[model samples]
Target: MSTAPLLSVDWTDHVTGRRGHLVVDRLVRGVASGGLRMREGCTAEEVAGLARGMTMKEALHYDPRNRYVPLGGAKGGIDCDPRSAEAYGVLVRYLRAMRPFVERFWTTGEDLGLTQDLVDRAAAEAGLVSSIQAVYPLLDDEEEARRRLADAFAVEVDGIGLDELVGGCGVAEAALTALDRAGVPYAGTRVSVQGLGTMGGATARFLDRAGLRVVAVADVKGSIVNPDGLDVEALLAARDAHGTVDRSVLRPGDREEGPDAWLSADAEVLVPAAVSYAIDTEAQERIRARWIVEAANMPVLAEAEERLTARGVVVLPDVVVNSGTNAWWWWTLFGDVEAEADQAFAQVRGAMRALVGRILDRSEAAGVTPRAAAHALVEERLPEIAERYGWY
Candidate 1:
């Protein structure tokens, strides 16, 4: 409901010719956290939108009734291709310029075009610590498992990369929850994912493992489809470093080329996990899926959302669907990780399932779209919190 951003900054690297924006929607508990994305044609407005979504996500997750975690929403973007040779230098310069902000108020992790390794290196070069890393204990061997006990707390610390699994698992669980709310069976359900990057690939793999058929997956290069369901593991293994699935690795009959092939795939669930505004009005017309799980931020346009709602399609908002990383951060910092890494993942999944189910149920009860219900839930508390803290 708010049209203005809390904080927005644009910066450029004179030497590397890099430019970017940082937008913080709100500061909760004196801190705001989100991811730094690098992609061609990214804009400050887009970054601001993502930052706002983060605020909504955190507000809902940490609501007094839910009490999942306490965080605020923010996002940063660099308008450059990470594949370019100058990317490293650009990232370093960006980090250096934003060092003060990163340390004082905003903490960012990896997003679309950026990798966790790149973010870690950039943060190191900037002499700043990642927010998530700050909470984790320093381990010379990430693979070694160590258990520690306190007066009332015991936890196991392992080097396993739990953050890597959070987003995908969250998305998959949200989708499953939506299906259950709609009384749709997961078994034999077809899914089409509109990106094969970290979030998208992980979503596809998780859904496939959960007995949903991932019938199609798309990357920037193109799409590949098989009604019988693509080999999720094989496709993952065949993906290049850039996350593009090699067409050669697919069966000869599975390959398909079209700007909108993935969007039109015959499936029950469609996940737009690659880019923003993937399902505009025109694209929405081509959507055959009953459910649209937004794995990417703001993938559905407002008009498209309205249209989809009128058509009885359930559009899960990105804020709720992609809260896995946020939940993972909260759990790593506060929850008991004494069990295996999978236990942490299970916790996140269960949380997402409950949240999604509650939102969908509220929407149906109110005769409103799921997005409206989600926004209402967040807005109900955000204004009061903002007023109480004099943030408005």
Candidate 2:
């Protein structure tokens, strides 16, 4: 609650010769949950910051309306390139070493540069079970592999892949809620997405399906823009296994020269679903979107967010927009998964829309940003929770 992590652990993978950090911000009801990220230059401070955000996210999500599932916040990060051959070995050793902490204190899933398959494989090799899997026996490694294969083939595998569906679905729900609150129609609304990874790609696909024009999408390689709207399905089909859409598949007019082109594309909504600090000062200056639905954690920097707020851009914080995945996780862990994945997705979407609408309404009433309003809401409840647990 004080922004200082309750616990921090530095780990080294002796096998692959990599190092990482794990930070737990708080423990509510003796439980914490978050993702493990492996990026090129991840840092301990970054993991701590993400852990703080996760704490705030869990606080914001489990209000009185929902039967409080007391989950705390934690995050893990490794400063290694997951694309390297040594990556798998590094993960196996890391998980094996951290098995005790993971099983007892913090549970982690996939984040940037991490896939469910990797988590499953690492957990399996480490002889550890995820906290969620411990509670719900259905979420085993074989089932996870089946779900991954189903995702690859675009097949429905008995709702085993609901967790993946919720992230993008939640982003689209946030975007739609923002547009509706602003009195904008979805049919002709233009959207520009930065980062064509899992979250961004899902956001683009869902928004395009919802009748919004996806004008531009960018990845690490470069950007492509078509003012009329790009074919989301075609782009998905043409994308490489690494989630990069080849520029060669694009027409001459569709290609954008730089990676940051999506920042300046003509659109009403901009969804930054990539890495953190995407909307820096320079990006803030070039942004043309009136609304930003953050699909990634802390994609916009503090100064850039302030600038966007001053420019009257309605920036939806990631705490609200991206919390759907957490909601889905809770639902799957507690709710009956015998139901269809679409049904679960619809439930999560409705909850997200309601939460977003409430946050926006409160922000408007208080004449503050949604981020501020949501944080205030969480802060108001933290004292009672901490007092009950003696967290101070």
Candidate 3:
């Protein structure tokens, strides 16, 4: 699709009795509605770009009869960290302030440091009901898999258990898809997952249950690697309230307490699920995994993605890996828990497998990286969708 202006968007900060202008860019409205993004350094241009990306992402994963369809994407930005109560409150207020606009076309979800509780708080303060609640599964349970997505415009969550479950399930499905495309057997495959928050931890558990050996997993504090595979169930059982695994409870192994330790683990598959740009130039050189799947958005920088691709490392794009959050919004909003889980797991796995296989095949044919091919595919689809809607 053409990278053209879609919708005009602007951000104004009126917290200190004076308005502070941030970003004003295009908001591309597709078939229905779009996602809302919250970030620290979000520019009007960047957020617009993300909005456009959402347009393409939704078009690629189209669902009819929903206003908050993937086809239409909306986003928001707050210059605050989602981890702090004060910052979170401020963001929620900002979101409430933006409700006039949010009510018009966008469905808000958490992204990048935003939490479900924060999203709910913001919606409540604004007297705005979550679109998730008006829909299916969440309309029934609204607690588990159909919870709020906080950061990254429907990517992060405050306390949405269902959202996390679905997101992780999507990543795992994408990983399995890439593995199948590469003719790599995932059963008994040694896997290492870095970053054990909602996305990382959930993906780790899902993959482990799928019969893959979860050899190593890490979080903010530290990393634990066992070549013989760590029992994810046991680790999850011991996880603390903050999602940190009490290292003292696990059987000791060749453990390390550094950010880079996760890269050195002996594994066939490596999933970087922690943070953005986690894999750098130096870390890329030392990576031992034959396949790398990014469960985290932009976990590998553009440069690192290039190097890994050059070395024949198959990296599945986040566009494919972490789509569960988006899918959950619809499922939770429109269906039951059992139906939502079944559809989410099936969708991510099936789509990942298909998308990876197609991208890899095209990459081989065109002598480009899988990442490049994935980008090309999305780019191709976006413009077509836009044109179909008479946007261009």
Stretches of candidate 2 above 4 Å error? 15-17, 63-68, 131-161, 251-253, 336-339, 384-392
Model 3 per-residue lDDT at 182: 60
Best by TM-score: 2
> By summed lDDT, which 10 consecutive residues of candidate 1 come out lowest?
144-153
For candidate 3, what's the RMSD?
5.5
The TM-scores of all predictions, comma-separated, are 0.89, 0.90, 0.79
Candidate 1 per-residue lDDT, tens place, 1-392, comes to 46777789999889866789999887765677789999888999899999998888877776454323355678999999988898888888888888877877786888988877678878898777653342233233323222221211233223223455668889999998877766888899999998877788788888998999988888878888888888988888787656788777787557676757889999989999998988899989998899999999999999989999889888999988988877665545453343345676777788898889888888889998888889988888787666644452
> For each candidate, what is the lDDT?
0.78, 0.79, 0.63
Measured with C-alpha atoms, the lDDT of residue 92 in candidate 3 is 54
**Candidate 2: pairs in clash:** none
lDDT of candidate 3 vs native? 0.63
Pick by lDDT: 2 or 3, better one: 2
lDDT of 1: 0.78
**Which candidate model has the greater TM-score, 1 or 3?**
1
Question: What order do you get sorting by TM-score, best first?
Answer: 2, 1, 3
